[model samples]
Target: MFLNKNRFFSNTDLIGFALLALLIFVMLPVGLDVFRLNLFGKYLTYAFVAIGLVLCWGAGGILSLGQGVFFGLGGYCMAMFLKLEASSPEATKIQSTPGIPDFMDWNQIAEIPFWWQPFHSLTFSLVAVIIIPVIFAFIIGVAMFRRRVGGVYFAIITQAIAAILTILIIGQQGYTGGVNGITDLRTLKGWDIRTDDAKVILYFVNGGLLFACLFIAQIIRKSKLGRILIAMRDQEDRVRFSGYDVANFKIFVFCAGAAFAAVGGAMFTLQVGFMSPSFVGIVPSIEMVIFCAVGGRLSIIGAVYGALLVNLAKTTFSELFPELWLLGLGGLFIAVVLAFPNGLAGIYKDYVEPRIALIFKRKMHIDEDVSKYDPLEAAAD
Candidate 1:
């Protein structure tokens, strides 16, 4: 059991964590150019959603298809702050409204909206990034889970919510920046984020955030709560009959997942420099699920790799064969489901891990034999 003793991480987990740390912190940064590194940083943002999904869907069996909504909410909150900073009176002197965002001016809004006012303060915006999404998730979780909603029905409801939110943003062009989203994000507290140095710095920052989320996921996975979640997933009726409030457990993990996704969304906006309604829509939400599925939903670290590899492939294939990109993505998902149902981590465990372990075992045996035959040990004997 992953919940054995008080160990938060087993031997395999330590190796996974160390290797991921090396790859994300050292190898990738050292190898890739700033542009490609920044791209991976964006990919890492999705990994946050995947990690949360590992807890929500993998453990708690709470599948949320509208995760992109939380992600977008976080990104928009950050974007609002950045946009406000960039929309200074001095900077937008030529506009009709010299102090407000350009989109507001273009849409004939003479003054800043009251809701946008709070975003001027970076602290408020940063806090809102997490809080706003968590609040949304909490509301949804409570409304659905309390009523015994789960599985496909819950997923559909979330998906519908994502669509509705997307439509609302698109309709409220003046407020939400419509389909184009909040763009021209320039600085973070007067520091220009467009520079190469800032991009690299942000990439490392993104990597750090990812590991933080991963650690939290691992804690939950190894704790009693994690075991409970698993039991609830497999035998919900029995667990509920045992005096546990299944709905409450589901809500907790779901909200936690939303919070993780929101953080990712905020980091994404900081790195990518924009937040659009397109990202808040159903398609992106489903893609986020695909990221989790491909990575091995049961494994937190594997989800990170899944996010990176899938996004990397998307970038590569989209540029090379634009027409076939969607098909390829769909096909990949099908293959993962049909063949390697457990995703990349499952593949590693089933085939790759055993071979590696066998080689290590052989090496250990050889070392023992050599030590026993050593001239010094033999003479002593």
Candidate 2:
């Protein structure tokens, strides 16, 4: 009966399905609690960023060091809308302070900047979260990929972009919120963001989004485009010679990855209820890369696991040994890299595959002996 089923339901598929089901079941209960739920939501956001890294660095061999730029762009977009909604009607009319955010006061600015106008609408801000990062990535990808820039050169360029973005945000005191980024967010769509129910709902939403992303990533990994991406990663010059537009592919993936980061950023803003220039700086960008590396860059599941594990450790270490948190994290990274260069996913594979293979081998040996030896021969032996 089992043999009559579709071949696609192999051992790996069964195991994967079982694991996913378990994860959902376990998360459902934890998500019911506000604090744990919020923590999980944060992890989901980090998972989204890590997934973007998986696509760019793992699949495309493009190490984007500026993912935080896209993340910050989306975060600020949502933050602006929230701020606009939170402001009083009378406050919205004053030219200098009209719908002016609190940060303007810190900068001693009297009026709202013209550029902050479009973000007044929730719809526009949401749309911009997806669009702005994509557009930025498209332009950057075209320029760099067209010039055949990659590897360390590509990484360095992206890092510079992140650094510059951070500086620009800090310098643009009035508009960009300067050092003390957008804060004191009270609500979302009139719902008290600080309430426990809202937090649980957010957690469920985050879990759903994480699952959806995993499904989409799995589909992409199995599709023809995924194969092409792997081909590009393995031999870009050969792929170009084979009539494929390598530049276009690279740009597409970059833009897609950026969009993913933007989504994560928007969601993160909702959970954290604030956006800061520091969130988009070089250190955060590097941290995103570290999440992907610690997870297993090539595997989406690995990325999720890595983000959760790393963030959980961060929280624990910070609570228990605040001063030693960075040291412990650094040591953890070094240990993972040395032990399983391919990341935590590799460790899982190594542990599972050999055990499964051993079981199958033992079963096969038993069957072979049963078939080869007659009852009389066995008795004589």
Tens-digit lDDT track for model 1 on 10-37? 6778999999999999999999999989
Q: Candidate 2's error at 56, in angstroms?
A: 1.1
Model 2 weakest 10-residue run by lDDT: 372-381
Per-residue error at 89 for model 2, in Å?
Answer: 3.6
For candidate 2, write residues 18-39 as lDDT tens digits: 6765675475454456687687
CA lDDT of every candidate: 0.89, 0.78
lDDT for model 1, on a 0 to 1 scale? 0.89
What is the lDDT for 16 in model 1?
A: 96
Q: Model 2 segments beyond 4 Å from truth? A: 1-14, 90-98, 360-381
